[model samples]
Target: MNFREFAAKNVHRNVKAYFAYFLSSSISAALLFSFTMIILHPNLGAIDLPEYLIKALNITTVIAYLFLFFFVFYSVSVFLKSRYKEFGILYIIGASKKQIQRMISIENMIISSVSALLGIIAGLVFSKILLAVSGKLLGFNALEFYLPVKAMLITFIAFVIIGIVISIFCSFIIKEDMVLKLLKGTKKPKTEPKTSTILAITCVVLLTTGYYLSVTSSTKTLAGRIIPVTLMVIVATYLLFSQLTIFIIKLLKRNRTLYMKKTSVLWISNLLYRIKDNTRMFFLITITSTVALASIGSVYAYWRDKEAQIDRSFPQAFFFSDIYDNSSMVDEKVNFIEGSLKNEGIKYTKVNDEMKFIIPKGEKDQVVIIKEDTYKKLSSILYLNAANLSENETILAMPLTKHGRKNVVLENIELEVASKLDKGIIPAFYEEVYVVKDEAYEKIKGVKVYFNTINVKDYKNTLNISNNYYNNFPQDNVNKYYNNLLKSGILRATKVAYGVILFSAIFIGLIFFVTTGSFLYNKCYMDIIEDKKKYNQLNKIGLTFKEIKKILNIEIGVLFLFPYIIAVIHYIFAISALKYAFELNIAVPSLQVIFIVLIAQIIYFIIIRKNYLLEIKKSLL
Candidate 1:
């Protein structure tokens, strides 16, 4: 056969070994191609999208390109490593080093060319769906799909160049001097896997410390500690797989009763070497899966809880406030809003209150002062408890702040804190508010501000009314008003932005997860030669196929499952930090993400196990 024909036949003969690598490369190409198509779409610019949306898409596209490069490089290296023995055989049969490199180049080019073509076709098939989803998330009209010649050309060229470059780099990974080691492959191992006591203990300490900081740190401190905590956890997880796991397995082996059990001896003996060989792979998978889960869970939680956040920040449907001197203008705006609401047949309740700004004796910040009667009327509308303040006592109203009774000297008047309200009755524009007795309010000297807060029966449906008021009397330094409709519009925009984030995160996360599984799969098949020889020997000694299956199940299960379990543990601590940082209860969404990933992992494990068993079985026959 000619040289190029030999290379092509080699790829075709070892297609099983190349399957995962091919699949990963194709999917990566498709992901990049789809993203490019969206970015280059003619309709993307016509839609009224957020300014950062296109920037975000561009950034994500760049990230995807980088990811594709790394993934291709890594997969190629692993695939070549698994074929070192084959290369050694070819070398003994008179294949020159340069000839081998040429063969590898040809094989890689074939795979890359075919993968790129298939990926482009897949991208074309899914482009419409991608655009539809993007349109929905961006809150724009459906983006029309065009024949993206530029995208197709770019993705195809980029993928092919990356593949060729990676293949050339990978060809040197098998050295001429390492022919003996390559020939031996997995058969040369004689030393027992060793664990470092100090590193194992350090792993425990680091993980505990990281988890502690992640769960205990407050929002104020979380930002500063995030990097340190992440580094600790990552280092600890590496040690966990490389040192701690081996240490535990060694300890388990000492228990004669458990170790002597049927198939336990078989699987455990195999597991020690397998785990040692796969330590780095397991660590990589665990880290990748943890990042994916945390990203998708956090963004999903944020999108789900957005409306509740809006409710907390905006308690009133419509709020208008201005200096008492601007009562003429304020009156005109309020009349216009109320008239519009009435004409639209919207039922509402209006509460009027006057706030006086006073600088405390020892504080430069102004505190808003309102009468107890007005506080009660507004509280009644919000269904909050009305506070009863004595002549010299006042209630502090602040959201998410807890404090005990304290005294404040407002303009020479000493006021005792009677109580506190965790919920804000007034708009957030007023930082701190004090509710005092009417007689006491009259005694305080400060600038007087009059404001009205209205609650509509269906405040969510008042967007048009809110927009009308905003259009007529736009907010400025002089005209201070909180239109629920305007705020809702802003909230909608925020949701759209977050939705885009969630959308991108979901796709990226899925890609990471799929690639992670492919990595494990390729690693497993890389050992198939050794596993078949080992199991075939046992089969000669009266080990039934059933027993062999059981042993294989245990081995593959541990290899595939433990990393994900560790990843979930890491994700739990991660989202715990998120919960504390955002002060949002994201437990449900986080759990849902975990459950979904767990299911996907289980399914993947089942499929890999079946395929692995079949390979081993074929060797035995």
Candidate 2:
């Protein structure tokens, strides 16, 4: 028989179990495809966003791909382990390991091709949907046909390569083992995780140091050093999950008083057994949960911290009105507010200033004569600066700040000059410690200060005054004054980033929810099925399905909540990441992201509980 026929018949043997992997992988593939296209596509994404943001998205896509790849390989390995006896039987029937390997390869190729095709197609369609959604939020028109052939090709190539490599490696390991060993491997008891007080203390020290460095600004080179520490923490965390989690569960189980008093003991023990096979899945899930929460939390943090930056940018209040005809004058409202402040006995500091004049010192201060020629019109012996000297010649200079700090001479200014400052302003005036004399300022004609900033009582009152004036205007005028100009692009980009993160959270959460619950139920349910006789014996001793299911529901909920706790810890670490990169300060304790995570856990547990209850009731009947 052909591989298709062989797969068609035998694939259903582990239907509920492998189905979880199939669905989870398909969803992951779809997400990965869409994200890869959006990030790497030269023409896609926002033009106005910071270039760093696009680079960050590319990094995120790579991280997601690595996680998905691990889970896919893990799932395949689990399948091989579960069906080792089946492979042994095939060997007994005179099937060569190489022949069996070929069949397995062909079967995997067919399944993967179908799934990737379906997934990429769905991903392409979803890309258009998200594109339109993102475009509308960004205030832009979507391209008529957004899918690119090159993108699909890359995704297909990636999926196929991963499948082939995993399949080949799997078969190699199986070929090394004899049928006897293969069959016996299935019955071997699981080895519990090894943990010690020393290891636990070490983990705590590593995590605490990492988290402390993350939250505080005391650490320098946060940019350069974070990578090494982050990698270290990730390793330590995995080691903890592998060692400490099982230790905790075993300890809880050994406490007979605590264990026998409730059903948590049974669920914890089952979770410990599942952990061996599902370790990678749990780790990936924890990372994704962290990423999902950080994505939304960052944007919310942006808005909360908005007011703080505005204060730094402008420290004034009620300094003006919309008296555009008199743009430079102090408004009557400003005077009135000052009077009110005086009446209240409030000593508000007021500094009115406008002094911006340019002067010429020498050839260095003369911008006009020598440096004016265009590159295309340049002739021989053209010099960048007025002073022509050896290449080794050097000079020093300083720059001025608005705060009036003495200019520190970082470098000397350079310019071409016709002669001494017979005329007024010059280029060197732009450079601080610019040796331009006061006489040059007088010579410079018609150079006027742009605006006088009168520092006032409160910045918000000034903003409020501006808003009230604008609100009084008609609709079209408001767009002309503000919305269509200053803020339109900034809001669009921020909104898209927030939306993408939130959408991914919900999508990935569902994928995890369904996969974890079904995978667990599929494994646990099989044991429950075989134990039908045992459960029947229990029923004979007077335990009802309701009592059993109630216990099961509580047990499953606790079990589902287990990895989620670690996921949340990861989320907490992710929060401080933005502090090192972008200033993210959200007032909310990221409680919303945590809440969404909790909701996902509930959904998964509910699904597991429902399946277990249905089976228990049916078995009782």
Candidate 3:
């Protein structure tokens, strides 16, 4: 047979070994194609999508490509390493190094071609669904799909280059002495896995310090310490899997009572070697999974909290500020807003109030002062309790206030501080507000600014009204007027912007998760020959199939679950840090994401376990 035929046949024979690698490459290509299609869609620009959204798509596409390169390179290296014995056999049968390199190049090209074709087809099949979902998130009614020629070309070319570069790079991985080493393969004796006591203790200390910093640091300080905290956790996690885990397992082995339990001796002995061999895999999975969970969790939490954030920042449906004291302009705008609301059959309440900006007797900073009657009216409309104040008494409405200050003197009037409000009743722009009794308010002399705050029954449905007012009286400063509809538009735009990010994050996370699973599966089956021999010998020594199955369960279960548990621990600390930094209560969304990932991991574990057991059972037959 010709060299090309030989290479093709080799691939067919090693399909099982190449399957995960093929699947990962194909999926990576498909994702890149789909994202590119969305970015290049003709309708995308027409939809008025925020500029940042487009930028985000481009950035994520670049990131996906980079990840694809890393994943492909890593997978190819692992696959080649697993085939050392096969390479040794070929070398012994007269195949030169140059010929072997040529064979690998041909085989890799064939796989890459087929994978790229399948991926393009898959992208085409799912393009409509993807566009539809993206359109919905972006608030576009329709994102019609046309032929994605550009995306196809980009994806195909990208993967082809990656395949060529990887094949060439991997061809040089074999060493001059690899032939003898590969021939001996599993016949080489393994020394006991060793651990450093110092490193193990260092791991504990680093992890403790990392978790403590994440949970206890204030938002202001956390920003500066993010890099340090992340580095600590990452280093600690590596040591945790490499040194700490092996150290603990060795300690457990020293316990005679626990070590001698039925079947415990069997699995425990096997687990020590397995954990040592797969330490790097475990670390990779844990770190990548933690990143996936934390990213999706943070974005999901922000999306869920968008509405409440708006409510806190904009307390009323409509607010008009007469900053220039232009009564005619204010009157005209208010009339148009009220007329539009009435015309749309919308129910609303309007409250008129004037704020006086006054500097205290000696302080340069100005505090906003509003009368108690207006406060009562606005509070009643907003369904909040109004402060009860007597003459010369005031309520301090400011964020993060200290209660030590007793009173304030504005001009000649002295007002006793009755109580403090953590958040402002009006818009958050008026940072410090003093709600004084009408008698006290009239005595203070300062620049008076009139404001009209309106609360509507169905505020969300006022987009058209807000648009009409904006069209008629377009204002330059958005802060002067708070239209619920306009504010909601901004919120929608923000959602669309973050929604794109969240969508990309979700897909990236899922890709990471699936790749990790594939890596674990490949690692398991790579040692099938060794496991077959080991288990067959045990069978001949009177170990029953049932007992073998029990041992397999413990071994496989730990192989699947240990890394996942560590990832969950890491994710908890990450989400906790986000909570403290943002002051957001996101437990519900965070838990939901964790639960879903856990379910997916459990299902994947079951499938892998079932197939792995079946392969081992063949040895018994």
Candidate 4:
């Protein structure tokens, strides 16, 4: 048979072995294609997407493509390694190296062609749905789905290039290795693996340091610490898997009683090889899983907290600000605000506070004094109980205040402190505010500003009505209160933006999880040949099917769960650090993600276990 026929027959015969690689490649291609369509959509640029957001999407698409390349390369290399003996046999039968290379290339091209087609077809089918979901997240009224010609061309070209590269790379694998080595395959063993004392020590030290930094580092220092700590953790995880874990397993084997347990001898005898062989893979899976968890968790957490931020920053629907020194325009500005809200048919309540900006004669820090009655109005509006104030007592309403200290001397007035307000009810003014009796406030000769806070029943509709005011108002530093009120609209827009980002993160994270799971699945299945040979020997020595199953369970269970357990541990600490830094509770969102991932992993384990046991049964038969 010619090379093409040989290649076709080989793929048809071993399709099971190629299935994981094929599916993952198709999925990756589909995702890339879908994203490319969005990027090339004629109307995408016309939408209200921020330039930075557009740029981020573009960058992530490129990153996805790059990730696909490496992922495909790795899968191909592993699959090729499994076929080493087959290729060696062909070489020994007088098939020229050039013909073998051609056969391998043809096989890869066929697989890539099928994968790319499946991926593009999937993308075509889902592109509209994906775009619609994205549009809804972005709060766009409508986004017509259209498959752009350029997108299809780009995707085809990209995957074609990937196919060529894989083919070329696979050719080198055949050329470099000696025929004898290829024939021996994974059975070739020389020196036994020994634990490295230095590496074990380094692993412990590095991991402890990394975990300590991750746990203790707060948000303020997170940026500076995350990079270095991550590098340390990555290195440490590799070393631990490669040396420390193997060392511990060896120690366990040395425990005579435990080592003599049923099936322990069977599984433990070759555990060292499995651990050593898969150390790098385990590290990769753990790190990738952690990244997926952290990214999706962080984005969801931030998205969940967006509303709280908006509420804190824009407490009132609209607030008026004017220099109290020019008390003349205060009423005029208040009238304008009230009339504007009325024009929008917005039902509203108003809280008015008069304040004087002062530098306590000897102190340089500016402070604002308001009447007790005004403080009560502000408090009532904020749903906070009014503070009881006496003529001789003043309450300090500071945004950022010391916890226990309570005295302030303003203009030689020894004002007895009644209480303190952490954040004033009306957040329009951000100065150190003092609430005192009307008589006390009138006595101070200082510039006065009027704060007119408007609370509407439906602020969203009011925002639309007040759009004219926002556009008309020229933003000077003094008129920030008006500007802040306009911020409510921006907040609404930002919520949609964040929603889109959260959706994107979830999708990207899912891809990572699927790819990682596929890698582990493929590796486990590929080892079945060796497993069957070893287990057959045990079966002849009176090992029952149940014992074989138990052995396989322990082996496969460890293979499936080891990376996940480590990943979850890393994820928890990383999230805890984020929580400490941002002072935001991500517990609910984090738990939700954890639950979903856990469920997915359980399902994957069940499927893989079933398939593995079936393969073992077939091998025995």
Candidate 5:
């Protein structure tokens, strides 16, 4: 047959196979298309974005495409594996390897093309919604909603090139012999279940060590060390996720009473057994869940802490700042600010914040790791960001108390240990921070700023006043900086919040869908097979499908609850540690996440149980 007829016949013969191919292709295409909109926007000139932002966009775009590419590759592998017998059949019918290769290539092209179109449309719509939603959340009026043609073009090209290369490689490697070998499915292969006591003990030890390093080890300014430690925890968490539950289940089964107790026991045992065979998928789901939760938590925590930053920086409704005292806009803005505050019946005093810069004798880039709560206190005084660290030198920046003096251990101009009175000043409450004078400030020449700090009648009204003051005067330097940040922040915060919610629904829902869905489906499939023979044998002894399904439902419920129970307990202790590290005094997400999980579980239960009931009712009738 010609390629066209070959393609047509293949599609007609295997719609299910083609559908799977298209579904995966569509997913990849959509990711690429959406990223295109983000990176290749036409209206970039409106905001004077830094080059690094563009670079970051490019990097994330590339990474997203890579993730999608890997995902597609995985789907293709599964599809080929499932259709091995079909490949063998083609060979059996005397199709040459070259002919088979061509057919596969054509099929790949058709699948990719259709999926690309679907993905592009979906990407445009998704990007537009994302832009709009981000706009609404961040309170920005300028809507950056559009389909990026450049991104579309880029994604299209990448998709085609990558698809062709991967397709060719897979085809070249899809030896006809393997398909023939599996034409008659082999019996379950003998393999060891990963349930040894030694493995369990090793998992515990590795995870505990990782957790210890993350929680207690200081990593303030030392980003280098933090990376390895974080990686360790990530690695340990995944390893334990793969091996823990199976071992626990196996250990429980050693007890005759516990093993034979109720439907719950049997159910848990069966689930642990089944999942043992699919540890890789289970590990993936756990990893996704962990990352999703961490990303969402990080964003919200930053937002929550932003209030303190606004409080510190913008104490009054009207304020202004200048570097090197060079800006003419400050006086104008300050005058304008005073006028507006008076109009609103608010009283405030402008405080002159002349800071002394101090440099201690030795090293630059002083690095130290501390719990985040302590970091916050030190950051407020020093003006540094808190991150994971892997160093010992504690760098603290604090405003010099005196007008001019040199009290530092080291004296050098370029390396003179001078002070920078700009951002990242170290606080006095923390011992790591030191105060110096103007001469020390002169050492650090890159940053020079005069800060006009003000205090207002109400804390609640502070943000509003800051907003209005910036809105009225766009030309002021302080306002300009704030506006730039506000614009970008709104875009980011909205994306982060929406991403959290979306992944929350999609990721959590997916696991529940798969884990519960397959369990229920298996129940029905097993019933059909067993009733034909095993059920007949049991029925003669008075066992019924009604009894079997009841046992199955109870089994499903207990097995399903196992993960959540463990998750909740882990979550509680985890949050407690978080609170200590971050100094959080308010409501925690442990309850919230748990509540969401419960709701998902209930919905899952209803859907799965309903199907199980239907199957039983149908059989009984």
Candidate 6:
């Protein structure tokens, strides 16, 4: 048969084995195509969104494509290792080294072409659904969906070129000495593998240092320390699997009593070889999985913290402000906004109030004073309790009367404390504010700040309204807060940009996880033949089928659980540092991410273990 025919037959025989890698690659292509569809959408120009958002979307798409290259490279490398013995047999039958390389290269090219084609077809099927969801999040009222010819062309060309480049690279990986290694593939080595004591100690030291640095770095220095800490952790993880794990296994073997226990004997007998052979694979999986989980967790935590931040920074949707003496000067701007909201048929309620601040004639300091009615209205909006105030009674807003002082005296006006509001009433420059009856507020002599807050029934309508208001009455020294520009701008950008980032992080994280699973799946199957031979020999020595199955469960369980445990510990410390940096309580989000990752791990472990045991059973028969 011709080389193409031979490779085609081989691929057909191994189609089931290649299914996971094929599906993951195709899905990755579809996701990339979806992002590209958004980029190519004509309606983006029709919408009035921030330039940074568009740029961020573009940058993230490119990053996804770049990530695909590395993902494909690693996956292809693992695949080549599994096929080494097959290639060695062909070489033994007088196939020239160059000929063998050519055949292998051609086979991979076929797989790549087919995988990419499947991906493009899947992309065509799902890109529109993804785009529609993305458009909704980005506040696009109507994002036109059409055939993304440019995206298709780009994806096809990019993946095709990647295939070609990787094919050439894979050809060179087979050297003269590699034939002998391939010939002995999956065979038991003459000598047992041993761990280096110094390397094991280094693992402990590096991991401890990495954990310390990750947890203790101040927010100011954390950004600068990211690279060093990441390197330390990666090196430590490698040593953990390669040296520390092997050392521990060797210690377990030396413990005669424990080693002789039920299943322990079988586990130690099998695990010693398994750990030695899979250490490097375990290290790779651990690091990659940690990165994926951490990326998703951090972004999710940030997204969750935004709501409280928005509330703190912007108490009301649209609040107008000016000196009370210049209330007339700001009347036109406020009237314009009210008229515009009415013209748009938008429902809103207005609160008109003046905050009186007492500034001593010779001093630069000021203390805010809120009238009783104003305090009640603003408190309702801010979700704080507004206590009834007698003429002499006052409630100090948060951070002001934190000391629980019963009496507060401002500018010769003495008032008894009724209660303290833990949150801000309006966005104020000073945290200290006093609540008093209208009679007391009107009696104080100070500058008066006029503020009018327009509360919308729905914040979603603010984008268009705020846009139009800015277009007409732009910010000036006298009309600084006229259109509520600062708060509205922040609201719009956060909703759009953060929405995209969080979505992208989740999408890419799942892809990384699938690739991690594919790696483990292929590795598990590749070792099945060796496991069958060894276990079949054990069967002759009176090991029953049930006992053998139990041994296999322990073996696979350790393999799967070790990396996940280490990764979770790494992520927990990473998030704790982020909590300090962002100054927000991330406990809820952290727990959520942990739950998600653990569930996914458990599901994957169950599937792999089931299939692995089936293979071993078949081998035993």
Q: The CA-based lDDT of model 2 is what? A: 0.53
Candidate 6 ranges beyond 4 A from true positions? 139-145, 186-232, 304-306, 319-332, 341-422, 425-464, 474-489, 577-592
Off by over 4 Å in 1: 39-41, 140-146, 319-343, 349-374, 391-422, 427-454, 465-485
Ranking by lDDT: 1, 3, 4, 6, 2, 5
The prediction achieving the highest lDDT against the true structure is 1
Clashing pairs in 6: none
Overlapping backbone residue pairs in candidate 5 total 23
Winner on lDDT between 3 and 6 is 3
Model 6 accuracy (lDDT, Cα): 0.75
Query: Between 2 and 3, whose lDDT is larger?
Result: 3
lDDT of 5 at 206: 66
Cα-based TM-score, every candidate: 0.88, 0.61, 0.87, 0.84, 0.64, 0.78
Relative to the true structure, how large is the alpha-carbon lDDT of every model?
A: 0.81, 0.53, 0.81, 0.76, 0.50, 0.75
lDDT of 3 by residue, 1-621 (tens): 999999999999999888878887787778778878887889887766667777787888877788778877777787788888888888888889888888888888888878888889999999889989877766566589899998899989988888799888987886545899877754668898889999999999999999999887664577887899899999998998889988988988999899999888898888888989998999999999998998898888887887776676567877777654665566567778888888878888888768888888888777789889888988899887877888878888764323445799977888788888755578766657889888878888887887776778766787777767767776564542332234545566667777788888877887788778778877877777788889999999998889989998888888888898899998888888877765666899989998999998899889878888898898899
lDDT of 3: 0.81
Candidate 3 residue-wise lDDT at 418: 87
Predicted structure 6: clash tally: 0
Encode model 2's per-residue lDDT on 1-621: one tens digit a residue: 775677666666656665666666676667667666655545554354466556556566666656556656666766676667778888888878787787667656655666677778888877877666544433346534565677677777777876797778778667635889776645766676556767666777777777766665322345765676677567667656666666777788888888877555545666677665556656655655555555556555654455453332222332222223443333443455455556655555443322233333432332221112211121111112332323222122221112122221112333222122211111122233222223332334423332222343343333333444335433344211111111122234445555444444444454444445444544554455544665677678887776676666655564467667876776676676666444445436477767766886777677666766777778888
Better of 1 and 4 by TM-score: 1
lDDT for predicted candidate 1 compared with the true structure: 0.81
Q: What RMSD, rounded to one decimal, does every model reach?
A: 3.6, 14.9, 3.9, 4.5, 9.7, 6.0
TM-score winner between 2 and 5, please give it: 5
